[model samples]
Target: MKHVLLATTGESPQVVTETLFALHQEHQPWPDALYLITTSRGQSKAREGLLERGHLARLCDELGVKQPLFDNSHILVVPDANGVPVDDARSLEDHEALANFIMTQVRNLTADPQQSVHASLAGGRKTMTFYLGYAMSLLGRQQDRLSHVLVSKGYESLADFWYPSQQQGQLHDRQGAPLLTAEGKPLIASAATVTLAPIPFVRHRQSLPAILPQTGESVHFRDVVRLINLGEQPEALRLQIDLAQQLITVSDEESDQRFEFKPSLIGLAFYAMMARATCAEESDLTRPSKKRADTALLKVFLDELMPLCGLQSCADWQTGLKQLLDWSELKGQVKDNTIDALNGGIPDYWFDQRKSELRKLFEQKLPLTVSRWLSPEIIWAEDGALLEQPGSTKGGGYGIPLARKNIEIINC
Candidate 1:
């Protein structure tokens, strides 16, 4: 009789799917019982407690992998005083306990004196993988067994595997054909050097060496990276400005007019409302500055605007703005009269208050301005003279104006 044990942490669905495929391939020749060992962290979740463990469990069940409902008979999931599971115990101790539990369970399965055990380490975090492998080592199979599956070039999608640095900046086809040279190959390939990082496999006592390699002489177009984060680099600001200048040079204003003046009106409205609300609370405009207003705008946009616009799923601003606005509240405000309560004209105060409130909302809700490769420098002044604006710079804060389009400063 053969017992095949597959250990995993179940952190990602991709891991589970890949492991299942590999298990089915390996177990094709013989009749085998399956054992799934998952750490506490491997449990899959759906939307933060709405339905936590069901998603991954169902996935496993669909693949015909079987396991008991609980980890073992001795331990149960009991709630604390706050009704939360305090599962943070000794990691190594938990591994030993689990190993003992598995050994006990397998003992009751068959009466055959010559039983062979096969263990596969395919998924889970590094620590979990190491612990499971350690347990399996102690169990010690008496047959042909191996800890890791050796992958070549095509198996890039494997859980923790990575290509060597010597292969970096090189594009390979599915059949492992070189697509481009790593160094500068203008049209089809640009010869360039790319650094690859080493992957640590503590369980198997194996590590890959770092390599930086040059590719061949062709740019297969498929080798290009579509998305990259420039992060907080000043070079990002220059890149965007360069791109904009290039666009302006190649395309006439008449041809690209459609893309030019579509200022973020909803973004503007959000900032306006925040600034207005905070300014009304205190007679001083300094009380609700642009930075503060931007922060507030971000909060409302994330918590309220995205949900109301039915764009919560995507969290994209373009989709949010395209949704229809009822404008019912604006109409109601227009009809109401609260002029005598304020010495300043109510209409004027209302407009100013609304603008400031929107500004405050954006200041609060929007992410802090940072340099990105696509960020434009048309708005920011170089000498720091334009840094100071309308509001108070009292508390280690820089002033930003609510009405200006170029308030973003990418100093990085």
Candidate 2:
């Protein structure tokens, strides 16, 4: 298995060299690959000190260690709320963005089973380290490792000190003052000692259900924590899909709290269909296929979908679904159920698209915890492979964990 070294750094880019120094010279040596996470200013320090000045290369060359695959691409600059790299993480929005970025990075690396990640919590702000640590707890596998590098006390935070080099006789502090020994001899880089401290962290992935983390490019910190901490939600809240107003409403009887917001048309359909099925206490709905058309599936879809049409506020979606299904109009209303299948069926891409987009919508609009509670948990195939079965419980279709009594579909 390829060992990957991932580190979070701040103004002190030396952490990278320190970590490599403490690990690479002897035991476990340099990783097969290396990655760094830092802010805009931090990236500048890393670029200048580690790359431009050739410090990283020099350290490896002198230590007789093979360099790992790394460059500017491996240096991930933490983006701000606007998706722009920020000099520092300070604002509330910046912190949230940082957390999401860190989570995304961690999840992406861990998603690959072939690679074992060695995460270095040796740099960056406390919040950055905390987020990285928590992400490891949530997604880290047995092969994964977490650590923080400890530098000799006097050598810590010294800008000029990347790693101790016996070639240099004197080192300067951040203020540019020469560091010297008690005998008045100039301090050499060899005076610094760096050690790796392995931190034992609880791996929650083994204990929790696989679906809780929401596999994809991004996951919000609040949602994951809430999902893990607040597992098996209480049944006091009811959900509503207001077709007329194009809104999904959540009301709590015990707390007397109500939340209302509009969702994407496709997401609306997928969710509303499931909500309708639950209310009727019907069987699980099968996923739409991308390849061949199944009349039974189309009919079942229209049966729940047609009732949602005929509203002025929902016209935009009406037109979209019309085009999607290649339908000029239904043969009759949802009650008649005689809509003929002019074409084979709608593309299954719509189904997958809805799954991803709908989850994002819920994550963006609903309460952090409530969003996960309302998401459609799909048992997606490994690749583009379509699941052949129909029932949600068996892993081939869509499943909503909510009970029948909790869903209320309001027609236009």
Candidate 3:
């Protein structure tokens, strides 16, 4: 029984939407067993607040995910209340329970005479995804497999990702025709008339920008790492895009004190990894003891960027950056200092200059050109309003549909 493990955790409604979207898109064999582990609160505000509303419940219903019975089959439920907190003293105990849950589920799935297992770790918190993945490594049979869908680019529209159906909409004016130009001469032009079909369950509106975008919110940097691992999903892309947008919104909010600083999503992600890697807590978290130096942060940062930067293809530049970052991490070197500690060693301008240069290089190398890849034409119904039928649950129902209505467009 090739069991595809489609799981989701966190507050982003998009996570579940993307998971279901992927499952349907591939038309892959259905899971023999399924598991979902929800969390109650987290080390970060967004994570903690995710469980606050009826968000999880609504997501499950919208996606048609069955509640888990474990039934020696598959199961789904919240960890502690919704999910176990990483910072909670009970993390070890919670981790054990998670391991057991996975073990039990896998054992049941593979018990049949004609069964094989294949699990896909699509979405969840970092600890949750990591712990679950680690557990799968242990319990997986020789035939059992594990995989994760990574985002090669960012969020994209569903239309671009999926082929559209002509039955869903109609094009009125289809033409390659000659028209009178400014000189009253005929010129070739193209045009089309189209009609849109209904879209359901999508939140079409954009929210107002927050105050103090650059000040940075209480973001769970760890969560960002985990979500990014599930690359290219519309949900994952939106979460990252939303973060970048929020930062801009915050800057808008604190306009009086705002400075012109646009933090690149890739840069911020790399910075977060460095902050966590060099933290004394991480040294303790790992098994084998390794030396912790100020420069260690720079090394960690470079290692993370190497893959994303496609450095292996550019060996000369890769070697140069690696050596420079290595030197920057050395004792008494000021380059490795967190954003707060620049003044005592290298001039503050140098740090900013390096970051600017790095950002430019990345832009040149891997430009944010999702637009160039594919453009999803989301056709909204005649009503500019989004919430379909506020209180109704009929066929046309009430809410906007996730797959097509609030169509997400990601550049490849």
Best by TM-score: 2
Q: Where does model 3 exceed 4 Å of error?
A: 1-8, 41-75, 78-91, 151-412
RMSD for each of the candidates: 24.6, 10.6, 27.2
* Model 1, runs deviating above 4 Å: 23-31, 45-114, 149-412
Model 2 per-residue lDDT tens digits across residues 78-104: 888889998887789988898988988
Going through the candidates in the order shown, the clash numbers are: 61, 2, 35
As for lDDT, the candidate ahead, 1 or 3, is: 3
Error of 2 at 349 (Å): 35
TM-scores for every predicted model: 0.26, 0.59, 0.27
Query: Which lDDT values do the candidates have, in the order given?
Result: 0.31, 0.70, 0.34
Give the C-alpha lDDT of model 1: 0.31
Count backbone clashes in candidate 3.
Answer: 35
Give model 2's clash tally.
2
How do the residues 314-396 of candidate 3 rate in per-residue lDDT, one tens digit apiece?
Answer: 23433535454454456323244433342223232433454454334323312122111111111122243333322122111
lDDT of 2: 0.70
RMSD of 1: 24.6
Query: Cα lDDT of model 3 overall?
Result: 0.34
Name the 10 consecutive residues with the lowest summed lDDT in model 2: 333-342
Tens digits of per-residue lDDT for model 1, 317-404: 3333233222223333211132121212123333345445433432231112221112111112222333233232342222223223
Q: Can you list the residue pairs that collide in candidate 2? A: 164-189, 290-348
